[model samples]
Target: MPVELVALIGLLVVFATTTLLDVNMGAVAFVAAFVVGSLVAGVPVERVISDGFPAELFLTLVGVTYLFAIARDNGTITWLTSAGVRLVRGRLVLVPWVMFVVTGLLAMAGAPLVAVIAVLAPVALEFARRYDINPLLMGLMVVNGGAAGGLAPSSVLGSLSNAVVERNGLSIDPGLLFAGSAVFNVLLGAVGFVLFGGSRLAGVRTSAREPAVVRTSGPGATTAPAVAGSRLNGHRLATLAGLVVLAVGALAFEVNIGVLAMTVAVALSIASPAAGRRAVPQVAWPTVLLVCGTLTYVELLQSLGTLEYLGRGVAAVGVPIVAALIICGIGALGSAFASTIGMLGALIPLAVPLLGDSTLSATALITALAISSLVVDASPLSSTGALVVANSPESQRDRVFRQLLAWGFSLIVVAPVTTCLVFVLPGA
Candidate 1:
């Protein structure tokens, strides 16, 4: 069999094993990457490690989680959660939208989507557990908001896509793309709100009542405050300062988030060794493993020509509209397990030839494709979704993972079709 075929089959096996058995998908992906990269694709082990391992992403996950873990350990998260609840007057339904808007603003301000999600998800999930809100609803809101914001002209996603289109000599409306993404995500968020019982939470008052006391029972127990009204102390103030610095440095200075976050975390640890010691182990290692491993396998697939082969085959179809749909589907599916920006880079250009020959609107088709590719960031395999699953209460992590997986896969079908109908068909 061809190396692409072998790599593709290896990917399926990894998914099946991870889903069916009690196994870490990252471990499975590492093995698959090695086998596919070395044995099937004739690449060396050093090349595989150098090329496939996502060191930047791994560091980002570790640094962000570590910083947040310290914040959680020192009560900053509780302070923020309480402040947020009070701001909304204990209206549970509004909390998700608050998170959504906050994340969106961060993304629009040029913060990386994964960084925003990592920083916010733990706090959001804590709020969900404290107030009996659905964790999935809260998590999805954060992811959606981040994604919506990521379409801004200054955002990483938006800038890259705009540059790609412009370089390819295709004209695109940045404002329309941003608006379309934001509106679509808002609509999806509204649907999620209703489906997850956002209405039932209306008028539900928790602020007037005594706040629940979160406690850690034993080893491996998740830590939370027994009461939400804890007054901010020196440690929390310092941690909050560190977080602000992180955000400013990342967004304004364009410093590497992973390196900057790690530096800040180390500083906080040195300042308060006890809290730092407690927070070290709280970093989301499994999530890091899962995300890096999945991406590694995806890198192997790309190196083996599987992704481009499939994309080209689909884009070669004579029917421009049908080819557009196929490209959207490929973007959605590829992006669920890989990088969204990477998918945009690979798939959008594949349609260049079709765009040159066909009557389809470049703006609409590219916008639809961009939306289709990114709308699935809620998938557990994606960085945002993984952070959500990782941050859930221990008892709820598996359930959240399953729910996110289902939601992510569903978007693979629904997003592309909807985008086609709304953007592509109207123009066609």
Candidate 2:
């Protein structure tokens, strides 16, 4: 069999072992990458490690989790959640939407999805733990909300897609693309809100600064004092300042978030050695291993030409509608395990010839493909979902991570088809 075919089979085996054994998917994927690269693909070990490993992503996970871990220990997260509650007047149902709108606007204003999630996920997930709100809902809200504005003219994702289209001499309305993405995410957020226990929070109310959260459901649903919601002190103030620095530096300066975050975390650690010690153990190391391993497999596949090979095969069928759906399918599945922007960059070019068929709408097909690619960022294999899993309360980490994976995989199965039916076929 061809190496590309072997690589695809290796991926299926990784997923099967991970799912059936209930083991870490990333661990399985990481091991699979090495096996396929060294034996089946006839590649060397060093190249596998160097080429396939997601080094920058690994840094982003470690730095973001470490900084947030320190903040959680020092009570900054609690204070921030308290302040957030005050803004919403104790109406917990609005909390997720507030997160949705805030993150959406930030993306529209030009913050990358990763940057927005890095800065906001800790506080948001902490709120989920304290108030009995579903972490899945809040985490999804944070991710989808940030992604909602992904195609705005000023946004990096939007600029990249538009540039690709322009380079290919294809024309699409940039503004319409932005609007379509925003609406799709907003609807997804609403669905998650209704499905994942958001309705249970409607009748619950409390003071924003009461220092306690009320549990509205389950066996012992009752008011409980907030964990680590202590009065502000010097260290907490310093941590807040570091968060501000992270936000400003990440969004405005476009610094490498991993480097900037690590810098901030190290500074905070040096300033308070005790807090640093406590925070180190709280970093989401398991999620880190998982993401690195999974992405390594993604890299392995990309390097082996498996993804493009699949795309080329589907397009070769020569049926425009079927070809369009297949492209969207590839985009969704590929984006779930890799970067959405990267998927867009790679797959859009493959669809250009299909657009040249004269019967198809370039804008609709591209827009469908764009939305299909992005809607799966909540996958654990992707950075957004990994951040959510990494930042969640340790006790609930496993449960929330499971929910995110299920949700993400479902999107992988359903998003492409749905987006095609909605965005692509309408213009046909």
Give the TM-scores of the predictions, in the order they appear. 0.93, 0.94
* C-alpha lDDT (0 to 100) for residue 176 of candidate 1: 93
Best by lDDT: 2
- Badly placed stretches (over 4 Å) of model 2 are 210-230
Model 1 CA lDDT for position 141:
93
Poorest stretch of ten by lDDT in candidate 2: 213-222
Off by over 4 Å in 1: 208-229
lDDT of 2 by residue, 51-142 (tens): 98999999999999888877776667778888888888899989999988888888888888898888888878888987888888999999
The TM-score, computed over Cα atoms with residue i paired to residue i, of candidate 2 is 0.94
Looking at candidate 1, the ten consecutive residues that score lowest on lDDT are 210-219
Tens digits of per-residue lDDT for model 1, 60-118: 77887788777766667767788888899877778999999999998998887877786
